[model samples]
Target: MRGHRPALRTPRVRTRGAAIAAFVALAPLIPSAAAAVGAQEITVKLPYDCALPPGPQRVAVRVAATFPDRVAAGEAIRPTGVTTTVELPAGAVSDLTALKATTVVPETGLALDVAQRGAKAQALWRGTGPARPVAVPAEGSLTLRTTGDAPAVTAVVNGDLTLTATDLGVDLALGTADGAPATPASLSLTCTLAKDADGHGLLATVPVGPSATPAPSGSPSPSDSAAPGSGRPTAPASPTAPGTPKGPTTPATPTERAKGRTGHAPKVGDARAGSSADRPPAPPCVKKNPTDKSLNAYITGYANVRKLSGASLIPVSCVQIEQGDPEIAFPPDGSIHLLQKSDAYLDYQGRKQTPPFKSTFLTFGFAPTTATMVLEQAGPMTVASDVLLVFPDNIAETYVRAPLVLRVLDVEVNGTRLDVGPSCRTQTPLSSPEPDPATYPGPHLVMLGKGQLINGTDATGYVLTSGGPLTGEVTIPAFTGCGAGGEDLDRLLTASISGPGNYVKQIQGQTCAVGVEVPTEGQCTEDRQPYVVPKPER
Candidate 1:
């Protein structure tokens, strides 16, 4: 409604024919004042005005046209067709309901009623042109009526006029020039009524020109500021505090980096895999607090990563940066296998909730000595098998191979060596992992503080595995691929040995000796035998 074009005057051609013929031809154009009043052509709009509600609603057609000067009641003026339309504001609710209109010209005045419900509301009319469909867009105007009891509604011809009737069954009393009899106009309209779309009576009423009253000298002019009483002392400006940033410092320009504002870049971070100083402090690896801004940002970051990754697996990675006192131990092979509660939950478009914490433990391995992790269960989707890591240099990267998962084997602040996929079943899928620039794009790693792994597209939430369960789900950034229920979370554990014993003894917190197998060519098939770590004596 804010951007709608001004109401322009278009010529309405006159024609004479039966009611059926007139309806057929006039259906394209609005009926003229001559056709309705039996006088010279007069201009008016049918259903002269309407009441539109704040939300979506629909209304019907009001035929309008012009006539010669003034005409008495019972005189019929015939011409053209009837036009239909609606009024509304921008970003406001639209009338999506179905709408239809019917009109009748009684001996004295014209009457029209429009019905719109659901999506069937027809807000505009079309003329029957053989070649092309006539485009008669909806017209809406604004009218400033006097507020309070017995509100006076006048069409502001000077500015665009929009009449809104607040209530139904409102009385419309019309008077012609001096001593002319008043027209008793009564209109009852039903549909959705917005405060702005409300109409007082007719739609095609001629606007009354501005009154010729003289201006009062005491009235304030538009350009003049309000006058204040003299002798009032102006208040002194407050003194600035020491060591504080200057007030109203110029806003940061696009060319300037945001100073004092710090956080991890979207997806990239230090390439350092595990080190107290190099890695960002773990997120306390705690459950997300709903109102926590950092938590929200973290969740959003995770969601963004998931969107880019296009994987349905849950995300699990060590928190690298910390706002206050950030520190993490680097286990042998640079992997720290710590438990993590998810930050939020995600689901397929309103379908089913995927399991949560669907992934647990990651074993960091190097290409020379480590590189093989065990897979206890393959999980649900093959695509869910992947892990993203931020290197010491602040570069975010990913590794994917189903059934051969990674685990946090150890943590050492210095000289830490992380191991991955030692007992991992290769032949699953293997390649010296390389970051897809398009997916893992980022600024220089040395400059970034923290980063996030792109988790899969499942509902994400955090729940304490060791401590009391703190539960909360992250909000999906976009509405797509999310609804009430869907893939909630993903969890997995890769053992370091063969048989269920390797998997069973570990999760129970028992001391179990497990064997590790070295993967060949970054791919481990069943042919590889693992070194067994004997189970501890009970």
Candidate 2:
């Protein structure tokens, strides 16, 4: 939940809903990485507060770089294979979703503080990556893992050259799935490292002392011993060290080049999620009761039409379930019913998850109409697992009745956009039609989901402890509210999209650990997910 925006607010007046987000929530840990020099491997995970338009959100960062455990004086203190992973919680991503800029490829700028004896300087750790745009995932935080080379330090005095982390800036280049500029422009987030009382900012320290092997005649003299980009040198460098171009014959391959104190310009680097191995163990997880009790959840329900070729994904609006609530039940002959079938407040307005149903839904099995379907949670749904304790088998079954409002956004009946306004959506919340009043239960539409305990747990059928797939079948009811000014679009869509045997498979992501303390470390992660979809019931 660190970067999750649990709520997706609807657009008031004909807002063009684009696929605003696409992001990969990758693992932060990179397996065993070694530097060519066989230096000590150092990794640090730090917390920072990043300033965005929606305010400041906590950002977690893991930095991995290789440096000599100890270095002799006059020797270069260069850190190799510098990789920094920047993470933003799903809540923070929700803010960007609201802004309508979803896909992002970021360029990062960082500076690590350097100090040795009395000399103080800084090392540039600019990170770049390829333009693989990362989307705002339906669930989980957005992660950017990148590696780059930085300016190294040269030990001058006979002391420790301390490397400390400092604040950083990240500019996100918003792009679409096709790698084009999104509706909105780019966004910039400023993250300042949280001050650590224990000097946790210190990354590594290299001891500067006598070297068993002395510097060669052309080694950097004590004159210019300043770290690259340090602005001031402790001493002047040897003529050959500074690329001063001594004589023509000696111009052969200079070992070191002149590094400007102004620092290197930020460039786009390969930022894809690379392969990993030898992943180190994460810190122990600790959970505490939290003040916030609502867990953020997303239901990416894939709805199938009996006539369509494949299942169409219908992602629902953000829903919340109380924390610590036992989402289990015991039932044999009955189920929990809502409003006794006569609720007056049943309407089809709670619609926010709006994306044009992709995979061509052909009108009359031939014509293609630009159609948009928005799935809405009409009422508070229940996710309860029936624990049948009397039988030899636990026979755990989880049932969910999501009161839904399915809205059709647009219809291209010979260019009828002029006849109906944006407010003219599929009128009624989904409702099953019954001819007789005696059998008419209520005016609400619902999708039914059932889960059976399989992996051997108290509540294995329905994913409550974490997220997994919950599959069911939905019989889409007829449509109504979409006609205006003689354009009978609702009747046309009802005839095409409604029917039984429609499979419903919803993928749920991990919760923000509502009952756990804020910033739940390992207990709340970005990638814990359900592996398979439950078999759709008849």
The 0-to-1 C-alpha lDDT of every candidate, in the order given, reads 0.19, 0.44
Candidate 2 lDDT over 157-184, as tens digits, reads 3544566777666655555555556544
Model 1 residue runs over 4 Å out of place are 1-248, 253-323, 332-538
Candidate 2: where are CA atoms >4 Å away? 1-293, 323-359, 389-394, 412-420, 424-427, 431-461, 518-538
Clash count per candidate: 143, 27
- Give the C-alpha lDDT of model 2: 0.44
Question: How many steric clashes does model 2 contain?
Answer: 27
lDDT of each residue in 206-282, candidate 1, tens digit only: 11222223437774321221111111222211222233222121111211211111122112222211111111111
- Predicted model with the maximum lDDT: 2
For each candidate in turn, the TM-score is 0.15, 0.37
